[model samples]
Target chain A: MTASRENSSSFRNHTLTVLAIVLLFLFLWWADGSMAEDLGLSFLPEGLNGYEVQILNLVAVYGILAISLNIIYGFTGMFSLGHAGFMAIGAYVSALCVLTPDQKEMMWIIDEILPSLAALHTPFWFSVILGGLVATVFALLIGIPVLRLGGDYLGIATLGFSEIIRVLIVNATPITNGSLGIKGIPCHTDLFTSFIWLLVVVFCTVRLLSSNFGNVLKAVRDDEIAAQVMGINVFHTKLFSFCLGAFLAGVGGALLGNLLTTIDPKMFTFLLTYNILMIVVAGGLGSISGSIIGSVIITVLLEWLRVVEEPLNLGFVEIPGIPGMRMVVFSVCLLVIILYRREGIMGMREITWDGIAAFLSRFGRKKENRA
Target chain B: MSLELFLQHFFNALTLGSLYGLIAIGYTMVYGILRLINFAHGDILMLGAYFVFYGTTLFCLPWPVAVVVAILGSAGLGVLMDKIAYRPLRDAPRISALISAIAVSFFLESLAVVVFTGLPRPVHQPEWLVSIITIGGARLMPLTLLVPGVTAILVAALLYVVYHTKPGLAMQAISKDIETTRMLGVSVDKIIALAFAIGSALAAASGIMWALRYPQINPYMGVFPGFKAFIAAVFGGIGSIQGAVIGGLMLGFIEIMAVAFFPELSGYRDAFAFILLVVVLLVKPTGLFGEKQKEKI
Candidate 1:
């Protein structure tokens, strides 16, 4: 009877957590729509209003990227610096799929080729999924050889891979459109759609983390040799985690591409990877909640700094004439954080209901003891 | 590519490879002693290049004097980095050290940008070094010849220092067993600092040469070479100096030749390094010259 009661109570807590998440998602969605309407923001150039909504959509896209990157770097304890490459692969592929049919009609050479592919037009959503699949395939291919190598070696390999991808994108003229970049891509990303996608990704990610597989992933991260000895196929586990991470990164890239309505090789550089890596490190490794917090903090801080550098200059205290002062300040903050709070804000722990309950219980216990 | 172009490209590869080898020596030396990969080493190379640029342009020093000053400056910076960023994390987990190293790398790059601005400065090579020398059918710059010769001499000197001197023995002992070396009355900290100092000096030397060859100096220039040199260090065997040199040269040769032969695949130059790294790791995780480590349960 006691065991059944405990099970029911746990089930109730799980349902409550789900309900809370759902309510939060709905609130965010409503807020996003209302903000778009209130500000008269549009996601595209054709619309006069909705600039705020477009920015919000961009934030959601980057938030997805940060969360996806967290899966590989934070959750799996893998130091991958090639995430931008995976993102580029997805962006380029989707751009190609979206542009090829229309491009055939305009370009002489493309029109002479198999007209059937040109006839079968793909929607933005289909292109996004295809982009993600292509990126996932690339991840698997790249991960197969490098994932077995642990620590710094993997980091180096991934960095090399990303650079390689950038070069390939630049060279593949017919596919990636070369240095000119793939322009006139369909703009399908908006605040509502982006928020919905973010919710799905966050939900799936949180669910995956709470599952049995998540436990195994954490175990492998804690000690790979020990985990391997205990019968977990360490290679497969890493590959799965890395590929899933890559897939989400691909989706993020696709959304970003759609939002911008263009794809450029230069857009996916090591700098992008570094920025995401910095966010993950600042968020706290191996913590989902930390990633969300870090992404919001970094994105909002970066955007807000534009105002700080411009019209909001303090009177009688003129700031320096340097253009990239914000980046310098950001780097200093990163160094200070690493130097002092090396474990980050929350360390490796998560923000869970149990944690909150424990804190409340401790406060009550302290009061009782004082009495 | 034509025969002449192919030969020139090969020589170009060799010159580039030698510089990489020079930098890889520093990376291997530091890793050998501490088992920690210093991500900031490449930025130190950038610092060296900038120092040389300033010494030559601002201070009106001769090329040789500028080189010497740059090398010394980089060595001092390396020691400072160790003291500030890495020394405290020695007792922490390896991952923490890695993160700290990364943070230090970002800090250095940002600091460079703040000081120098993001503009790419032109590195003016001395006219004597810039003059082309034709050997038989091939054309070569004086700098190219100087690079290989200097690299070979430096490697030889490093080998002699590691094998012939008492300090070398102490370094080797610490690498083999840091605790045992300390128990035997060796100052492990001083020896390790010495290794970093020497490594930083070499990296600075390579950086100066690289800037002269490329003729462009940017704050973030070290990112690619730093990563490639790390790959080279791994290819040769992380802890081995000779291995690093060989690995670096091989990588340089492969990258240049690959681009020269297949102009269509020129963009894949970095990919070749990545693929080479992946292949090397898959085939031999211990590396070409590395010994397999057996851990006690």
Candidate 2:
């Protein structure tokens, strides 16, 4: 009887938690839409502008990227700097699929796009999936060979592959339109679509991490020889984590390209990979929810940090804006976090409902005493 | 390609490859001792170039004096980096050190951007270094010969120091086993710092030459050649100085010759090193002269 009672309460908590999240997402969706004024959200004064909405979308995209990286580097203990490459693959493939032949013709001013590729067109959702699948396939191909290497060697090898991939994209002018890049992509990515993808990614990754396979990944990470002794297929596990990370990274790239409506080969540089790595590290390497929170904070923090890049004035004095000052500050933050506070906010722990409730109750009691 | 064109390309390869070797030596020496890839080594090269640029233009120093000062400054910075960024994480997970290195790399690059400005500056090449000389109907920049000659002298001097000096033995011993070397009463930290100093100095030399070759200087310019040099180090053997030079020269040949022979594929020039890296990794994971993998147990 007590077991049943506990189950019911836990199920109720889960339902309440999910409902709360859904409601929050719905509010954001409505506020981001044009009809927000009609709903009498006068408190907001003005509904979110394009910049605000774009930041929100960026949060979702980065959330996906962080989680993907968390799986490859965090739980699996493989230091991969390949997110940019995988994302590039996903971005280009999805863009190609969704562009109409007319759009393709207009975009490929350098060289006419391949005749076979010109007619390709798929629904937005299908194209995103195709982007992810292509990335996954490419990941599989590289992962098979590279996974044999471990630690820093693997990182360097992956970085090399990512660079090679970018070079290929640049040279394949007939396909990727060379350096001109794809422009005027239909802006199919908004907060709702991107957040839904983020939810799906989080759900899947959380499930995978909790499964027996998750234990296997940890075992491999902690000690490869020990995992091998325990009859684990170490290579296969690393490959699976790598491919999953690549797939999500690809999807995130697809959304990012749509959100921006343009992508040049240069856009997918090592800096992008480093940014996601920073997010994963700052969010707490092994925490899923930490990635979400990290992405939100980082996405906002990046935009907020733009203030440092702008010219400053103190009534009597003025300081010219430093072009790369923000990145300097950003990299300094990452260095500090890695050195002094590597566990980050979550420290490999997940956010739980009871933990939240307990904090709230303690706060309420404190207020009562003060009164 | 005509014989003259071929000779010119060969000399170009020799110049580029030796510079790669010079830079790669720093990578190998540091990796040998610390088991860490100094991601900022490339940035150190950039700093080397900038320091020289400033020393000559901003400070009005002579070219040779500028080279010496730049090399010293970069070496000091490298040692400083080791003290501030990497030393604290000596006992932390290996990944922490690697991450710290990456962070330092980014920090230096971004810091360069902020301080130096993001614009690529034209490096004023000295007429003496860049003057073209025709020998037997083959015209070549003096640097095409000078870079290799300087690199050989420096490398030979380095090999002498590493192989013949007492501190050199300590460095080798440290690479073999840090704890054992410590037990033998060697100061590991001092040796490590020495390695960084030497590595940075050599990298500075390469950077100055690289600037001479390209005639342009920028904050972020060290990234590509740095990575390629790292690859050359790996190809030669991560811990072997001789291997790194040989590997670098081989890479330089492959890159220049491939472009020279196949003009159509010049666009893929950067891809060659990465491809070589992957191929080397698959075929000989330890590189040409890297030590065999030994399980600690």
User: Can you give the lDDT of residue B167 in candidate 1?
Assistant: 88
Clashing pairs in 1: A40-A49, A40-A50, A41-A49, A41-A50, A41-A51, A42-A49, A42-A50
The docking quality of candidate 1, as DockQ, is: 0.61
Per-residue C-alpha lDDT of model 2 across residues B1-297, encoded as one tens digit per residue = 789999999999999999899999999999988889899999999999999998999999999899999999999999999998888888989898899999999999999999899899999987887778997678998889999999999999999999999999999999999999999999999999999999999999999999999989998899998899999999998999999899989999999999999999999999999889888888998899999968773
DockQ values of all predictions: 0.61, 0.83
What's the number of clashes in each of the models? 7, 0
Q: State residue B204's C-alpha deviation in candidate 2, in Å.
A: 0.7
First chain TM-score for all predictions: 0.85, 0.94
- Could you say which candidate leads in lDDT? 2
Candidate 2 similarity to native, TM-score: 0.97
lDDT of 1 by residue, B7-105 (tens): 788789999899888889888998888878888999999999999999989999988898899999999999998888888877877767777787788
Q: For candidate 2, what is the lDDT?
A: 0.91
On residues A175-261, what C-alpha lDDT tens digit does candidate 2 reach at each position? Answer: 999888899889999878988898889888888888999999989888989999999999989999999999998999999999899
